[model samples]
Target chain A: MSRFTKIALIGLILFPFAFLLMLSLGKQWPYPAIFPEQWSLSNWQLVLGGSEGLGNSVLVSVLLSLSVATLSTSLSFWVSRHIAYHPKREAWLSLAYFPYVFAPVILAACLQFFFIVAGLYGTFGGVLVAQLFITFPYGVIFFSSFWNERLRSMEELVKTLGGSTAQAYAKVLVPVAKGALMTCFFQLFLISWFEYGLTNLIGVGKVPTLTLRVFQYVSEANIFLAALASCLLILPPVALLWLNRAVVFREG
Target chain B: MLTIKNINKQYKGEAVLQGLSFTLRAHEMLSILGRSGSGKTTLLKVLAGLETADSGQLLLDGQDLSPVPANQRGVVYLYQEALLFPHLNVFENIAFGLRLRRRPETEIKEKVNGLLQRLELPGQARKMPEQLSGGQRQRVAFGRALIIEPRVLLLDEPFGALDAETRRSMQQLLKRVAKDFGLTAIFVTHDLKEAMLMGDRLGMMQNGQLKIYGNRAEFIADESTGALDEARFWTDLQGLKLTK
Candidate 1:
């Protein structure tokens, strides 16, 4: 990158983070000061200390996101392999994009009655299902490009070398696609982690993820706590992106 | 011995392989020369069991192999492009078949190391496929195919992507490896010189049918092969030089 471009890119990232940190730390800035008049860590402490299940909410968000990412990514890998070369694979891919393109809040509204009847509404599982309905398609779309004739040829090579189907997956397919799979996993995790509209509608204020907590604090007019929760909400993906840059992209 | 009889295949109403038939004795190489759409690859794929022939009998040592799946058929097809397993290093790629068979580590090591040496890639056992040159990748692929002691090895234009010097060296190495392993091999290429140089017996494929020649003289004598025309042109040019 050129010097000016590098500076601009860093500024674009750090500036928002700096603004969020300031908002989280400030008691009342009230503008025209260029800095907070009063700063405190009380909001941060309150969220971290687990008052009204804040810490529990964070844990729930992490668990749900990780589970969704793992299930969808792993499932997509196997599913894409099977359907990739099918004569109707393009038609199937078009169907996969449908769930992703729909408005999540609207989809949630339509699915809410089914969830309530199934005894899933106001439950953790309800939130998980709702989020998965949105995120799983992303996984499918992410992996669709990777399942090609070249990969199939690799599978064939494995078979001709006396390896079984299971052996081909274990030895060749997984190893060759490991990097791309990891990148997809992280992406799905980010999608699930930051999801809000569907989680709110499905959970009905019963399941408390970090995004929900942020919204709750905002509704209560606690700006500092809201900002603090928002920062926490965004941190994992940022860290993951940085880690991916360092590991996968750098080596590749 | 390996024999293919009445192998026929069609795709979308177009015949890719039309009653293609051939035979090869043990330790002999048959090179099939053809244009791109001449069904050479389709024939090879049929033998490897990657593609099932619409009608054919594949015989190996007098046993019918038509009912066999690809893995059990003991037929290895090397693609025109070097299809080295990208995740594996040179040694692992070569040892892939042996490891799949659950062979002892010591045996795998001895066999792979021997192949590495013989293929002239002695110091490259640890390099990833991406790190190797086109020639090296193809050699590793050859070793990977040969290590399993397959009944027949089908090579589909294996050296087509290499530079001239690399192609020549790979051809020589292929001949040497086939001899050392006693491999029943079918080499496919569009290059006349490559087909002539690699095969113990040479054949030509046109419109999904194969015509095998008993010798180089016979192959050259066939006007449709382009060899005779090429020879006449060279001869006429030589005469002009003599007159000058």
Candidate 2:
């Protein structure tokens, strides 16, 4: 591609974010106006100052997604090794696809009764669990292919060389799987970060994640606040993508 | 000495190793020749404690090895592929077992460097597995296994993936190392010539049953072992060349 085309493509890709930033900083834009009538840092200040609870929502979203991604990525990586090597590997792997078979809202609806019975409904814990229903399975499926015959042989080789199971994982498998683990964590984070349907159903408006906040502002026709929330929602994933790119390039 | 007694293994009700028995002397390398699915790998895995025999006894130095876990078995199994840890350089790979044992840093460095020299991999210690050639990777793998001072090395076609020249050189290297270290090993291969060249004693596997020959002459005299056929083919080729 030519330099001009490259620049144009980059600008096109960045246009929406720039537009969102502009909208977030502006207000009172009526029809036939290319720009808003007023522009200030007041919306950012209100949100960051914690008056709108948008700051709290941002915190909740970060912690929730980080917990879900870390928990699910690690658990699935460990679990998938056993499942992949199990006699019933196909059956177990097929079950991982079961969650994706139902929409998240429908799935949340199905689990609502249990969450209520367990006294977790309309709570942060409920939303976290509800997100796990999606992200954990995704993580399992993502890592299933990483455990192959060569890796199995390597593990056994470690054992026969007088290294224990834990040593095999720590010294060899985990180091080799660093890239896969990071990629899985980033993907699971994104899934939980943008998760709206399940959180809405399970949270019952109590657990205000940033994704839910974005929807709330949009539905309330508070476009400026909505744009601000959208900007916050995209921040972590963009940062994660940048970090992931660095790792990939270094590995390459 | 390692003794395998009345070993029987079954897969889906079919016998893979049926009442297979053998004795390997200390410092002896026993090369077993067999085709694919002939149960050579099954035997080695059982000895390495990676796989359990359905019914048998694995006695190493007169102790039962069945109850021992693979890590405690003091047996290292090498595969056709070098199967090096991709993240480690040659030095670290060779030092892995010592590190696992929490040996002194100075000791690990001394032993690994010594083994690197012995394996003809000196000055290549800092290279990653992918940076090495096929034979070099196998040498590093040997260095790794030997660094652990394993009681028995179970090699499952360790040189099989290399070209003819590399394979020949690796065979010589392994033979020299085995003698110098006084290593006891079971080398499994499908190549007839390799089987003859590498073994202090030889065995042939047919339908999961292992037949050990008393000596090289006995192995060559056994027509069922296919040694005679191999000789006949080469002799006929030489005769054709002469006539031409």
Highest lDDT, which number?
2
Task: Report the alpha-carbon TM-score of model 1 versus the true structure.
Answer: 0.91
- Candidates' interface RMSDs, in order? 0.9, 0.5
The segments of candidate 2 whose C-alpha lies over 4 angstroms from its true place after superposition are none
lDDT of 1: 0.88
Residue A77 CA displacement from its true place in model 1, Å: 2.7
Models 1 onward score TM values of 0.91, 0.98
Candidate 2 local lDDT, B1-244, one digit each (tens): 9998999999889999999888999999998999999999999898899988999898999999999999998999999999989999999999989999999999998999899889998799899989999999999999999998999999999989999999999999999999999999999999999999999999999899999999999999999778999999999999999999
**Residue B126 deviation, candidate 1, in Å?**
2.4
Residue pairs with clashing backbones, model 2: none
> Candidate 2 chain B TM?
0.99
DockQ of each: 0.72, 0.93
True contacts kept of 1: 0.80
Query: For residues A219-248, could you state the per-residue lDDT of candidate 1 as single tens digits?
Result: 999878888888888887888889877767
Task: Look at candidate 2 and tell me the lDDT of residue B141.
Answer: 93
